[model samples]
Structures are given as structure tokens and as C-alpha cells.
Target: MSDEKVKIDVPEVPSVLPPAEQKKWVETYKAAFEEAQNDDPGDVVKQRQSALREANRLLRVEKITSADQAKALPKWKLVQCEEKDGVLKVVTIDGKKYSFGVGRGAKQQAPAGQGGGQNGAGQQGGGASTPPPAA
Candidate 1:
């Protein structure tokens, strides 16, 4: 017998959430978003947008896993976050809405060895700035 593995290719659907579930999740996100807006009531349009993105991402991962369709790269994104003027903003490919992780805590630290001495963003790992930090 040959020891060969069969490969299965699953189509990447825009959304893993079922139609009904998608609506429900969207509604939930909207509610959370409204609550945040009310609490802050400041000029944090971008931050709110980012929060919405992260929330939705988490929700999608939960839904997909529940549906037993979570593959290698569950498409989970911590949700790109940006902080400006004490307010945090988040965004994704398309205009999605979510409301979570707004002004939670300290900024995120890159997992060591991820961004070596490339892109002029400093060396990888130890967050070292290249060019030898102007001796």
C-alpha cells in the first residue's frame, strides 16, 4: 500500500458565518459599538472603527470554530489597532464594524525575532533600533 495523503481544498467564503448567524453577529456588534460611543462620547471615530473590527474578528473565529470549519490559519486577526491622541483606532480590508478592545491596556509588543533589521523599523526581537543607535 502507498502512504499517500489526500488533500482537500475548501473554498474560502467571504464569511464563514451562516446567513442568519451573520445578521445576528452584526446586530450584536452594532449594540456594543453604540454603547462604546455613548460611554466615550468623544472624537474617536477611528478608534471606534478599530474596536468594531477586532470584535468582529473574534466573533467570526468563534462562529467558524463552532461550525467545525476552522482550518490551519483560522483567519483570525487581532484587528489592526492604531492609537492617536489617547484614542485608539482600528481598521481592516473592507469597512467592517465591531466594538471591542478600546483603550484596554499597554501597547502590544512584537513576538521576538519577527522584525529583524529590516524595513528600517529597527532590528527584530529585542526592539533594537538599527544603525547601532548612533554610537
Candidate 2:
């Protein structure tokens, strides 16, 4: 074979946002991901807090990098972070913003078959119970 290298042509994928904006968001995501993975330790309380922060960061990463959210990344204008809560909330291009907490965007899963949607009307055993067997 000759010393000349083979050239491969790669097609550019179309994006809703301009390349510069996409690059900015991609860099932001990379920074956030790297920040979450840093595990430098401090005092006991700080260490615990760090662990919790790491966990929340990982959860946020999973949420944002998911298939559906990944597609929307180019449209994200801002990433709002709550350091106390350790949550990173994304603001979309159309100005929709949401914070993390109970019932914000995070969902609390009910135990399997528990039907946790009831409004505390003493609805336990809400399913029809079988009548007592004839004596």
C-alpha cells in the first residue's frame, strides 16, 4: 500500500439550533457531568453532603441525557442549579423552567400494587372485598 491515507467523508447531522449554540450546551453538559464525578473529600458532614450531591447529580445527568431529553439539549437556554438541593434544572428555549423537589419534575413511585393516588379518604382495601363465605 502507498503512504497516502484514506479519507472518509462524514455527513453532518441537522440540528434545530445553530452549531455554536449546540456546542455551548454540549460543553455545559460535559462540565456538569465532570463536576458531579469529582469526589474530593472534606469533613464528615461535608463528605455526607458531597455524597448526596453526587447522587443528585447522577440522577440529573440520567434525566437530562436520556433519549428524549438528549434531543432537546440543543434547545436548552439555561441550566439552573440549586446547590442546596443538588438539583440542576434546565430552562428550555421557549422559556419553560421547572425546579426540582417533591412533585416538581421528580416523581415519587408508589410501591407495586399500592395505588398511592388515593386522597386519604380511608381508601385502604378500596378494591371490592369478597363477601364472607356462608357458614
Put down candidate 2 lDDT per residue, 13-78, tens digits, no spaces: 224346664455444444443443343222334434443443333223232332234334533233
Q: Candidate 2 overall Cα lDDT vs. reference?
A: 0.35
How well does model 1 score by local distance difference test? 0.37
The local lDDT score (0 to 100) that residue 43 gets in candidate 2 is: 34
- Judged by lDDT, which candidate is best? 1
For model 2, the stretches where C-alpha displacement exceeds 4 angstroms are 1-14, 39-92, 95-135
- Candidate 1 lDDT at 56 equals 62
Specify the poorest-scoring 10-residue window by lDDT in model 1. Answer: 63-72
TM per model?
0.30, 0.21
Give stretches of model 1 more than 4 Å off: 1-14, 44-47, 57-135
Pairs in steric clash, model 1 = 47-88, 47-89, 50-90, 52-98, 52-99, 113-125, 115-124, 116-124
Superposed Cα deviation of residue 89, candidate 1 (Å): 36
